[model samples]
Target: MTWNCRGVGSKKFERGLRFLIQERNPDVIGLLETRVNFARAGEIFQKLGFKTWVAVPGMGFSGGIWVAWRDEVGCFVEKENAQYVHLRFSGQGQKDWLATIAYVCPRDKEKQHFWDDMAQFAQITQEPWVLLGDLNDIMAENEKKGGAPCNSRRCELFAERVSNCNLLDLGASGNRFTWKGPLIPGYERVYERLDRGLCNPSWRCLFQNAVVKNLTRLSCSDHNPLLLCSNDSGYGFGPRPFRFEAMWLMHSEFDAMLKGCWKGEGGLKNRLMNLQPNLLQWNKEVFQHIQNRKRKLLARIDGIQRKISNFNRPSWALINLEADLQKELEEVLHQEEVLWYQKSRGQWVNDGDRNTKFYHIRTVSRRRRNKIVMLRDVNGDWVEDQVALRQMAKDFYVDLYSEFHEETVQEKSLFDNCTVSFPSLQTEELCSMNREITKEEIKDAIFSIGAFKAPGEDGFPAVFFQRKWHIVGEDVVKYVFHLWQDLEDLKEINNTLLVLIPKVDRPDSLKQMRPLDYVM
Candidate 1:
């Protein structure tokens, strides 16, 4: 839990802290703006049942940060500054992870140093990481209300730092604003969401179902505490649909597999349909080998560690073997990173950052955001059951497209009376618009589109054609030529998948969704 405890030395703040610790029983607690000396902070930590604690002294009683955790959780301080405390933690059977508790200075000039420190830390750390606390900043304009408007430049810089660090906002529930100013009238009641939880991609992978909730503000403090909870069993357990990964193109055997599958097809579409089954089989047999190798490497590393621990002095040969295994493990991990990075579809993040954690979080966040947890039906009733929700969406969309009403004569006449005109095109302009598509133009058009986009109904993206152009180019060009020349109904090629995106935060009704057409 992260909280800005205005001043821990005060009786009211102390009482609030005690109540919070007793009520939540969190494994770790990070407090900012404590405004107390180290000795007093130590006494409070001891009384609060924290066996290990660290505190950074405040600047003349205006700012102080403290991080405390129970003895059961193994925690070691890795780094600390006036603005943040970084710690490495490990527990029984759990992977070691990093946590940084930060409290940014309210002053604008000091914020840059805080961001610089964080960026440096992110660059050096390679473990699962979570950074939480009051950033003293807002990411969006709407995050603040009743102020002289949040500094747009400041918010942009803050957002850029988050992106550069490869962090994803774990999105909070409960109150929209985490910090409130004095309740003065005349546009003085400032409110902002200054506190949030941000984590790296690895942390999201480890705690895939984690949620950050901004609890109600305590009476003694203006800031609300954020509670991070992990619900491991909340994710869907259904079998995942097969997706052709862009990373697979990097493999030596991918081209061979495609060539083998393409040899036995009829039309372009039929060939693709038949090739899918073979590709699925290849994924299971060949692509899955990478994961299998990872598991074997992990087993070998564990076995070697056990042997080294048992020996009084490990032999040189054992050390060499461990180093080799570690190197191979790192390479396998990089491959896995590439696989997830391609799957994430996060184009904003740079490729060299090795932001597998960011990619993992993006995928998880998208899944969670898109999930229909509950829906309001036509009868104005909320439906929670998965089958019921599915039926509701299905019925809503089906009726939307299937039901058609004939236009009345009066309504038809409204359009008939309306006249629209445009300037006439010159002969040269007309000729240019009517010109036939060249082979080079078709190739350029296909290449110009994003190669890693989501596939349409045919289950193929532009990348497939671009990568296997040598084998499939002739059929594709011929099909395009015929379609352009004949100008006939191409219903199969024209088929599209309709995807619904929410137009507002927390859309409960079908009318709130906007449809996007994904043409095959």
Candidate 2:
């Protein structure tokens, strides 16, 4: 829970906070603009049940922030200043995470340093992190009402900083505006969405059920409190979709694995159909343990460093072991970046800059944004149950495609009734258009495609063929020529999987989505 209390010294404000604590009892809570020094803040917090707490004294009754938590919450301040405080919670059975509560200065010049600090935090930490409190700015014009039209430049800057840091906005569920201005005689009072909750992809992945709700504003303050709730009952969307990772090409045994799968199949398509499960198994054994491998390497390196520091002179063998561990860690980090970059689908950015965390966050944001959480049915009623939604999707597509299939069976004499004369291609022109494809042309076409583009339903991207040309080129050539020899059966070679993607942020009806097909 986070609230810009404005001034906690008032009897009404103090009573309100006490009532809120009794009702909600949040794990961690932050109070902003307390208008109290450390000594006075301590006296008030003594009555609260929380055992651990940190406070930034107000600068002569202007601004202050306080963070407090119960013993089991295991919260401690990692970094702090007058503007913000970064807290770390010890995760007993899961990975640890950071929470930063900020009360940004209203002036842009004074807040630039906060943005710089946030960027540094993004680059350095792999932990799931969340930020909450009054930021003193809006993200878009729509987020402000009754204001001298929102400064687009300032809004853009705030939005860019949030995006660069890979922080996904944990959109509030209640009030559209968090803060309201005091009454002005001639001019209308202003309201803006300055206070909110935001978190990195790691955090979203960690707490998939996290939600933010804006509480009702109290009579004592202009800003409303925000409640953040998160749980760990995460479930998968459906059967795991197999995606061929680019890092698989980096493995020395990838060729051998492909050879094993290729030898027992009927054709290129059959072989590819059989290869998906094998690749999945291979990935589980080889690449899925990257994070664990990194941890072990780090532990070993730290042990060696400590050993060397304790000794007057370390042995050559010990030094060599440390060097080897360091190199292995570097390779692991690189492969990790490759993994996240592929998942992120952000090929526009060049690699080799150690952007693993950034990519990780990007992937999370994309998933959250794309997921169909709720939908409106034919009756215009909302449907949110997973099973019902899935059934609806299946029925809708089945009916649509079935009708389309029926319409496509039009007579071959569709143009026979036309009376107007039209230009026709010569026999030689027809031959040129339907000419046999050459092996050289096929090779050039495969090589020309981007290596890491989206994979087909066969779970293999162009990069797989581009890299394994030496082993699979002949089979690929034969498959292409076989389709040319029997043009009627070409649909067997044109394998595609149609997937529905939302065309808008909040797609209620199925019509708001479009079908995207993956080529094989």
Candidate 3:
């Protein structure tokens, strides 16, 4: 979400941001310009129940980047000397993910510094990360509608920077232009896809199903918001056909059935148990045959779709398309229903036709196809209601798990090789400080304490508290207080007591050590 707010203060921009958040309710948003100081922006975001990560370079008349995330997603902003926010999405038992939002000045020689800084950050983390923002450079001649004739040098530099980081641009969907100049009646308005999102190869794969939505401007800012929606891709179409075996139908009874059928005779039991392989193989073949026919039908439909897309005049094409689709749908309805009924004995239901077997096949096939189509549609669209969305979401996760299982198995090697180490310090040093408790232990204790709450049991767990501690600088023991802190709204989790511990490494250190227990 790149916007040239001209010179809007934190207050006005915040009201608008709140309105947008309420409207879209996106998990994350990237904002630009935001002439306000970093601290002021943080307050505005906090007021909206959002954790803000801002990158404001000192005293320069340049734009800045800020990302405001929902309170639930634990995000921390790493404030670097350079003008960019490094945000890490953290959670239990999950590999952490990082995303950086930047605002590059279009007319700065220091622009090179931004890329240099980002490249260094990438080299440092080497984790799955996304770097997205208004790069202030258009890649192609076609990308700029009326902006100053495209600068090949700047574009090349941006490309080189991205290549150096091994980052990729998620292909733009819908209109190519991201920002359009207010048009004068005769001449066409200049437009350019300056706002962009780039990610490492690993993160690219993670967001394989994610989409970059080019939204129409509400005339609030010069640049339109680019909404990125990462959805589950499991229930979607791919190169291979997904399968659910009929044997799974008897999965609940498998143990009992096997025990009863092959309990006594050793050799015979072995032979019977071995039959599982043949049974599964036969079921797979049956499933594949059905899948193949469905694929063929889908291919035929897609062929028509391609023709329709290529047709210069869509209105004329729709005439033939509607008739053809109707015929194809009717044929599909019949074959899916009638043939399925003949094969299965009252096991299936066809929702379209009253016959059980036929109804099951046709309705399921149609529903499945429709679901796939919906998945392929643009992001943030309400293609279906809650039930359909939930099912699709579930399917996507299942597919993701299946596809990534091998990758995850391979990731063990990476994890093993990863320099996952804690900063060296003894337990005695921790015990010496009144804050002997590790930060991880504190977090865990907070989480555990909240676990007893019904909301936590129901999955929306959170804890809110105010912390006061003594800040010691040798002879000076200055006491400062931090208040009304919601664990859900924690960003960065930096600034520790006594300046000794890093907050990120302690995941379960506080599980048994309560903050009150320390006083006790």
Candidate 4:
């Protein structure tokens, strides 16, 4: 946890500290702007049952930073200054990582210095790392609510600092605005999200389940407390859902595998469902470790080039081998990009676009933003138990759909009397609708859907049918003919996975969300 308590000398401040220590029992905590000398800061934390502590002396009574931790997280100060403290810490059986907690000066020039210092740190630090603190600046203008208009130049500087460090914000839950200013006469108190956790890609990948939540600000200060959970809370629902990966299409063996697995004794839907297990097994054997494969291929290519460079009489076979490996590496890289792009759900990416890291960051950030750590029940009570949260969500949708059914039954006749004002289909249009669906029409409809669109329960995306049309087209067209004969055959094709998407940021109630039907 990290907090800028304004001043930590008061009894109230100590009481709050005591409460926090007992409540969360965090492994390590950082106190920013403690406004007390090192001795006083030590005295307070030591008396509060912290097993070990360290501090940077205050600049008069306005600035000081302190870090204290129990044995659970061993903290050794690698570097320290009035502006920030860099620590090498480890806990919970994980490898050591770096944490740089900062208390940035609010002035532009001082913040600029902090940015430069951070950029320098970025260059040297290669371990999994995170930077957290009351940064004293917002990343964007919208991060400030009622404050004097943010300086666009300052905002850009902070964003660039983050980019230069290759750090992505861990994003926060609970309070969006973590700091509030003294009330102005004509306006309410200004608010801004000045405190946050930012981690480099390695750190994010290291602690994929890590989260930084902004707790309510202590009454003694304007800045909210940040609680960092560096490991999984053990609330994960289940194994990840399977989706048809577009990257699999890039594999040379993918088409042959489809041809072998596509033959089965079921119709299109059942055969598609049967193909899931085969695809899963084939993926495990073939494309399971794409990155590792890419690394090895690149290494081989490098070795081959080195041999060619060092030996003027390098064999003709050697050159051809190098060319083959390069082609294979290109294909693997393309597959990896496709995988990232699919996860990113980015519409801007095209076939040749290769901003893989950008897509990865977007994918990770979206997961963090959409994660539901807790919810509020209908009684307005916070529900934190994960299983209970799930049950509550399930019950909510069940009741919602039930109530709608009852209401529709009661008002079913209302629609019966409603007259259509829009243009009605002509006899020719009606005849066209009833005309037998043809093979060409089925193929056109299949291609019309987005290649990577969310699929039905069968898990076969449009791209699967589009690319393997020669192999699967006849069967798909036959299935369409069967469906036209008996519309009830639609049962297998209609299974869907209902997913709830939040309508607002940090939504706590089930009603504050909408559902998407993922046809299975």
Q: Pick the candidate with the highest TM-score.
A: 4
After superposition, candidate 2 runs with Cα above 4 Å error: 1-92, 95-128, 133-136, 142-149, 160-195, 200-235, 284-288, 296-330, 348-352, 376-382, 395-430, 487-495, 505-509
TM-score of 2: 0.65
Worst 10 residues of 2 by lDDT: 403-412
Candidate 2, lDDT over the whole model: 0.81
For residue 201, model 1's alpha carbon misses the true position, in angstroms, by 6.2
- lDDT tens digits, residue span 1-520, model 3: 4454544474556566667778767877766776656667676667777764454643375576666767677788765444567788888355778887777776666677887887787788767787777777766666677635678886777788888877777644434577767676666777878888778756754444555656556545777667666554544544432222222222334334334443343332243345455445644553234446556767777777777778777766555775776675565455455444432323444466645333343333332323322222224443323356456555644554574544556568888889888897689976776553445455444445422122211111121111111111110111111212232222322322111121322111211112211110
Question: What TM-scores do the predictions have?
Answer: 0.60, 0.65, 0.45, 0.86
Candidate 1 regions exceeding 4 Å error are 4-73, 76-85, 92-94, 105-126, 153-176, 182-184, 200-222, 229-238, 247-256, 259-271, 287-450, 466-513
Score each candidate by Cα lDDT.
0.80, 0.81, 0.54, 0.82
Give the number of the best model, judged by lDDT. Answer: 4
Error of 3 at 297 (Å): 41
Better of 1 and 3 by TM-score: 1
- Predicted candidate 1 versus true structure: per-residue lDDT over 39-105, tens digit per residue: 7767898988887899998667677889898888789999888888998988767799998898989
By TM-score, is 2 or 4 better?
A: 4
Which lDDT value does model 2 have at 61? 64
Across residues 1-520, which tens digit of lDDT does each residue of candidate 2 receive? 9999998879999898988888767888899998866667667777887767899875566679988887888677899888899998886687789999999888666689888889899999999999999999888887888846679998999999999888889875456689998656666789989899989878887876676767778988999999887662332377867778888787768888888778874778787778888888988886668889899999999999998888897788889999999988888888788888888888655655888867886787666555565577889766656789889988877876784644333433565555788899999998997887899998998898887788777677888899999988888888888877883378775778777886754456887788888784
Tens-digit lDDT string for candidate 4 (1-520)? 9998888878889888888878778888899998866788668877877768778875676678999987656678899888999999766577889998889988777778888888898998889999888998878877888746678987887888899888888987676689988788877679999999999987887777788878767888889899888886564646676688988988888889989988869777677778888889998898778889988998899998888898868688999999899889888888888888777777767667678878887777767666777677889776767788889988888877884545455356777777868889999999999888777888899999887776666667787889889988998888889889995367756767887787866576887789888752
